[model samples]
Target: MGKNDFLTPKAIANRIKAKGLQKLRWYCQMCQKQCRDENGFKCHCMSESHQRQMEVFGQNPNRIIDGYSEEFEQNFLELMKRSHRFSRVAATVVYNEFINDRHHVHMNSTQWATLTEFVKYLGRTGKCKVEETPKGWFITYIDRDSETLFKERQKNKRIKADLAEEEKQEREIRKQIERAEQLLPPEQNRESEVEDSAARELKLESGVKVGFALGNSAKLASKEKTEAAKLVFEEPESDRGMKRKADGGGSKSALEELMREEEKKKEKINRKDYWLCEGIVVKVMSKALAEKGYYKQKGVVRKVIEKYVGEIEMLDSKHVLRIDQQELETVIPQIGSLVRIVNGAYRGSNARLLAVDTDKFCAKVQIEKGVYDGRVLKAVEYEDICKIVQ
Candidate 1:
């Protein structure tokens, strides 16, 4: 058919409308043209321009595909690295952000069929840290920039250097303290010698200077005389030496005889004092126990005996300890008891006691704050709370 003969206004209008909505399926990538219909696309396929473009593409189609694939991968990784550097987010989230740009490389045109496959490729290639969670697959982009790696290494080196400096200073201070302690003994001896000399000078000024000097000489002579008297009256030097030799021979005999007598005496005392058992180490309750004097001077209790009675000394309050009692009475917080917080963020606020921990001496309370109700606070120490109402 002739062109004008087939181009009726009504026919032309219908063709134009079809062209407006017709899918541009057969497109020439190199020639950059779209045909309106199948017949038109077939005609264009036979055209010289389309044929030339096909010849160029046919020469090395793999190279063109590879270039496009590389571009797609580069654009995707850039988006992921910029948007979700540290976060382990879903691949779809990053893809959606990437597609927001109209010029962004489409995934369907790329080698990866799905986002999950692309993420898996990135993980396999060590481009990202990928993991599958209950929610979905997530990924963190790996930064391969040389400058960033250098900065991280520098930061770690500085931290290690600071630690080394601190350790060196600590060692120096320890050495100074040890040197100071070593000097203390000589310093104390010098002070003692000065004090003795001062005392001798004070005695000389008390009108006994010459007399004290002579008396000291005489005391020294008397000490020597006493030593001589001991040698003459107690035993002759030769006899004393001989006696020491004989005593050495009888040393084992003397020790055995002494041990027998001591055992007999110990048996007699053990019977009389056997009923006197030691007391146990218990929490004291009296004012005397609170004093530093009592802590410094009192001997420790070693045992708790039957029918043993002693006062509990807790600072000022005192309670008598009855050893015969089966159970010791202790104060315990009751449920629903009102208590005042003595410390912490909720100090001065009142709460209802919910539970008591006897072993820890603590309580769980429902704390009320402002319009908020019933906050469960755990392990509030007994000392940190006061019973307001039972």
Candidate 2:
């Protein structure tokens, strides 16, 4: 019944006027009030309640502003997560939506003077990925909660572990190389020590042989020279040693050379960042496929398209499907089973699985027949080696 009563028509009209967002300049942050115009804001500033709030703020301006800044940031990010968590939305669009809440924190009370500044702060703090295009600033939310951080930490740990294992394997290979080099001299000197010294020491004593003869000396000396010449020319032991070294050095087969060239090509292909290969058994890991009865089912890769998508024939169902490499997991075979190196240094080569380190998700494989024959890859990832379709 009263003019200023809550249920009066005048009070309803005021509420309706305040229902929508008002200009920031006419808002009184100290009293948490939004005025309709500059005159109203001026009048509110002159009021007792606003003056009291201003005095409190004046006592610790920095702390008050910082508190408001934190609250604004929290509310803004909360809205972003709830609405645009996985989208690239314009900053202005998000800001407009945020200000729709009647009781939302105002930007004038925060550290940033403008929305652009706030968005830039979000980028600098790594809260969102911000990019400026012709339309204005666009932002994508970056989830950094406990679960995301835990997953990222696990990924980094796996990477570091793999790098450490690779280094260990390289050191072991280097030691093997040193041991091999040390064993070579022994092979070249397998003959008797006296014979090796006589043969290895090819130079003659003082580069000449002294001979003295009495009567009939010329014929005897000539005969002696002929026998010495025969002995020098027929050096069977030294000749055999040289021939063995030559054979060992040239023992690389043509097949081995071809594999070496293929490895070089693979090294170049690795840069293309493609990993799919044909004739390998892989497990489908797609949640979408689960509804179609294909999730976790094994398949044989018949052909690879665009170096990423594969045409796979399901082993059990005999149905063909095209799937991205991301939805496929490599199938690890039993020890002694032949596997193809689908990634890493010896990619495209067939290797025999020697051992598996389940803890590290890596395997020790010996290259079966190639330039790296008998060479052991000590820490190939499970995904980098796969079983052939059988």
| Best-fitting candidate, scored by lDDT | 2
- For all predicted structures, in order, the TM-scores are 0.32, 0.47
- Model 1 residue 280 lDDT score: 20
lDDT of 2 by residue, 148-215 (tens): 87997897697557545554654674465345434445544454243422222221222211121222
User: Which portions of model 1 show Cα errors greater than 4 Å?
Assistant: 1-51, 144-147, 160-390
User: Each candidate: what lDDT?
Assistant: 0.51, 0.73
Error at 218, model 1, angstroms: 60
- lDDT tens per residue, model 1, 1-390: 565565777678766765533333544445655556788888998999888878887898888767767887898888877777777788778877876664555554456667777776675455776666678778777777889879868975975575455446545644653454444466654654555322111111111111111123434455542232121112234644564586663233332344345434433422221121232222322232345434222221233332222223323333333221111122224687666664443444567777888898888877654321444566777655655422
**Candidate RMSDs in order:** 32.9, 21.8
